[model samples]
Target: MTLSVLVTRATFADIAQRLHDHFDVDDNPDDALWDPDELKRRLQGKQGVMSHGSDRIDAALLDACPTLKAVCNVGVGYNNVDVEACTARGVLVTNTPDVLTETTADFGFALMMATARRIGESERFVRQGDWTKTGIFDMFAGSDVHGATLGILGMGRIGRAIARRGSLGFGMRVIYHNRSRLTAEAEAESGARYVDKSTLLREADHLVLVLPYSASSHHAIGAEELKRMKPTATLTNIARGGIVDDAALASALRAGTIAAAGLDVFEGEPRVHPALLGLSNVVLTPHIGSASIQTRRAMASLTVDNLIAALGAGPQAGQPPTPVNPEVLAARLR
Candidate 1:
């Protein structure tokens, strides 16, 4: 009997064809966003699912999908899929990690550069014909990226990549704080120095957030942290939503507590805080950090591969490439 698969977003023609040959693949490639109830309703009887960031596979969703054997997430972050709930229910969880690491790091740098230099705001000023009235001393004078101090919140693979680009490529000083410090070799390689969170905020001219989202990490940068930052410094978050307190950041931006900010992910996401939208000091993207077409395809393909292997199919057949909750395999094997 063939395994059944449900995909949250339709990726490519070849992808659907490939899965069709192996399983009864129902591709929701139409790209319509489904509400929680609609998602739960469509997930019934599915053995595997190729999900992206939008779907939230929480305890309730896991309980509703008894037949679900595995969940493959396209993006590196699997916080949307509750690993604890999936493991408890004996459902495997996986994410596409290495393929998009470099691409995401690239975007993180881009957001940081844009935020510090006021790229978007300046472009809009030119587009609106405001440049004709202004001299070289125009309002949106931005900061420099080269020789700036870089503070990274998380020092995982993506964070390491960012540190490399900052320290080596841009000649910036790198400082980071994580749950555990990196090896001496890694520290030397990225030229990253470990520092307390407050010190990093105080010193970094450009601070970038690439940490994962969790209850404890929520609002890691709030009013107090923002207050600690230099008035001329810029902040950027390419990490998940809820890492920075939105209201506090908004207040800081309005009050010029920090120079500027770039945000790819926001608290409550898709629906941003109204105050943030009104601020010219901030640049925002719709969580498209890993959105290159080539990278996105790679992510989707890897996610499918993980799901196939975890569910005892595909070329690797029982060999999962990435495992967010490897403990689930123990219960499934029984």
Candidate 2:
């Protein structure tokens, strides 16, 4: 009777099967992303909400949800959820972190290889019946992933995992740029050398962005940065959107400033920039970086756990595995 939950991405049928007995559940299985006003209307009586990457939980939304106790994001990145605002408003915020690290890292590597090797373009060509024994050298011959320089924009857990795959598994020379340098032991383990952003852009055979999005990170890779990259280099982004300037990236792709690009996320996502969509050199995918069936299910389950705990359903019910704004755990719960 004390717990109320609102789930945005997953359906009622899904959670009802699991938590119906413990809490009041309001679910939107249809996955309709409610606009600001509609979301405000929905949050009128809700104490907890489960959200996806697509949902925006910022200052405006926090101003409306007076009863909101917690927001459990189903994705690792909580950039969509403003931690400062939530902490101020006493709303507990948590995300799926370690559970999706390896899965997302694996995906970043996969997308990078796809971009460097022109995999998607080759597939489209073959599917269009363009294949023959001759295999025209210019048809789809692309860059090699092995023995290449792999550069990572952010060297967090997922980034380190990608570095291991590239450096240890593929014989790549890994380089990364982060806000702070990692310990010597970490560098030795991953075999990644820390370099400045410009050096990373110039030297890497392929670059992947895994950085978290924030005010300072918005448009981090714009014309100036993209122009520094090797013309033969490929680029991949599995990070949060807006980190790379979409318009700038599209121009680079169209102009062949970079060999090619693979993207699983975008700026202002779900509403991709039309220019980026029209380019053949760029492989666009619906944001599926953490979308493996198993990982997605785990994310869903973890989100549910956070919501139940947050609304005081049980022990660890109010204590999430990953809390972005831990201070909210002590705020007055009306």
Candidate 3:
């Protein structure tokens, strides 16, 4: 019998064709977002699944799909899946990493610049017929990006890339706060100095968040954290939603707790906070940190490689490239 697999979201046509050639593929070309019950129903009889960031795979879903052996996520972040639950049930979990690092970093830096310079607001001013009446001086004057202090909240691959861009290209001072410090060589390459979280908040002219989301990290930047930041500082988040409290962020923007903010992800996305809609100081975009064509294709290709290997097929069978729970495979061998 042929192995069965499900693609939870619509992907590039070429990637879909490759999946079809390998397994009994069930592709959702319409790209309809399914509720948990609907997703569980569709997953029945499927041995593997290709998932994106929005899909939630937890203990309950795993229990319902007894035959599931592998889950390959197209994005680097796996916060949507319960890796511990999958491991307990001997299910393999894999994610695509490294391929999206540079692209995501580029977007993060761009968002920061847009927020600091009020680029989005200025564009709107021009389109609104207000620019014709105003003089160039004191018109849409905004903060400078060059030679500013750039504080990063997570010094991972994407964070390091952003640091290099700030330090080498823009002559900005880069400081970061990570769960653990990077090696001396790594810091020297990125030109980032490690600092405590409080110092990072107090000193940075522009702050960027690239941390992962978890129960402990939820609302990591809340009312108190926002208050700690300089009144002139600009905040940018290209990381996952729910990492910052949206309600508090909206209030902060309104009160000028910070000069401006740029958010690519939000709490309960596709449904943004109503208060944020009216704020002129915030620049918002749908989650597209890694939306560049080349990077997205590479991510999809890596996911396919992981799925094929995890299902005991392809050239690298039994050696999935990026397993989140390698202990599960080790247990199976024992």
Candidate 4:
């Protein structure tokens, strides 16, 4: 019997075709965002699903889809999926990690630079015809990026990539705070010094958030944290939404708590806070951290590979490369 699979969102043509060739595939080519009930209805009888980061997979949904054996997420962060719930149900969970690390790191660095140097504000000023009335020195004077202190909240693969870019390419001093310290060799490669969270906040000229999102991390940068930051420092978030308090951030920008901010994600995404929309010091972009064409394709391919292997249908059958809960698979074998 052929296993059934569902693609929850539109993807690269080749990826959809590949899944079609291997399974009884049901794809949402229209790329509609399904609510919980609608998603549960669509998932009926499906043995596997290729999921986007926006799709929420939880115990209730898993209960609704008894046939689901695997969930392959196209993004590195699996915050959308309830791993413990999936594991209890013996449903394999996988995410694409390394494929988009460098691409995302590139965007993070770019957003930080844009925020620091007021690139987005200056562009808007030019387009609004305000530039014609102002002289060069008096118009849009912004902060410098070179030789600044670069603080990273997470020192994972992408964080290390950002640190290397700041330290080697831009001559910036790199500091980071993570749950644990990296190896001495890894530290030497990125040229980052591990510091306490408070120090990372106080000393950084430009702070970048690349940490994973979780219960403890939600509102990690709240109003109090904002007050701890230097008045001239710029905050850039290329990490998951809900990691920072958007309302607090807006207030911070208004009060000049920090010089500026660049955000690619939000607390309730696709529905940015009205307050942030009104601020000139804050630069906002819809979540597109790993959005480069080449990297997105790579991520799609990895998700497909994971789904195939998890369902025991493709090359490397029974061994999905990046399982979020490998113990579930081990328990199944036992």
**Per-model CA lDDT versus the true structure:** 0.89, 0.85, 0.94, 0.93
Superposed Cα deviation of residue 23, candidate 2 (Å): 1.2
Residue-wise lDDT of candidate 2 within 99-174, one digit each (tens)? 8889999899999988887889888978998776784658677899999999999999999999999989999999
Better of 2 and 3 by lDDT: 3
lDDT of 3: 0.94
TM-score of each: 0.97, 0.95, 0.98, 0.98
What global local distance difference test value does model 2 have? Answer: 0.85
Q: Look at candidate 3 and tell me the lDDT of residue 103.
A: 97
lDDT of 4 by residue, 1-334 (tens): 9999999999999877888878999999898988888889999999999998889999999998999999999899999999999999999999999999999999999999999888999899889987665456757677878899999999999999999999999999999999999999999999999999999999999999999999999999999999999999999999989999999999999999999999999997878999999999988999999999999999999999999999987777899999999997898789
* Model with the higher TM-score, candidate 1 or 2: 1
Model 3: per-residue Cα lDDT over 24-80, one tens digit each: 998898999988898899999999999988889999999999999999999999998
Q: What's the C-alpha lDDT at position 320 in model 4?
A: 93
Off by over 4 Å in 4: none
Better of 2 and 3 by TM-score: 3
Candidate with the larger TM-score of 1 and 4: 4
Residue 271 Cα positional deviation in candidate 4, in Å, after optimal superposition? 1.3
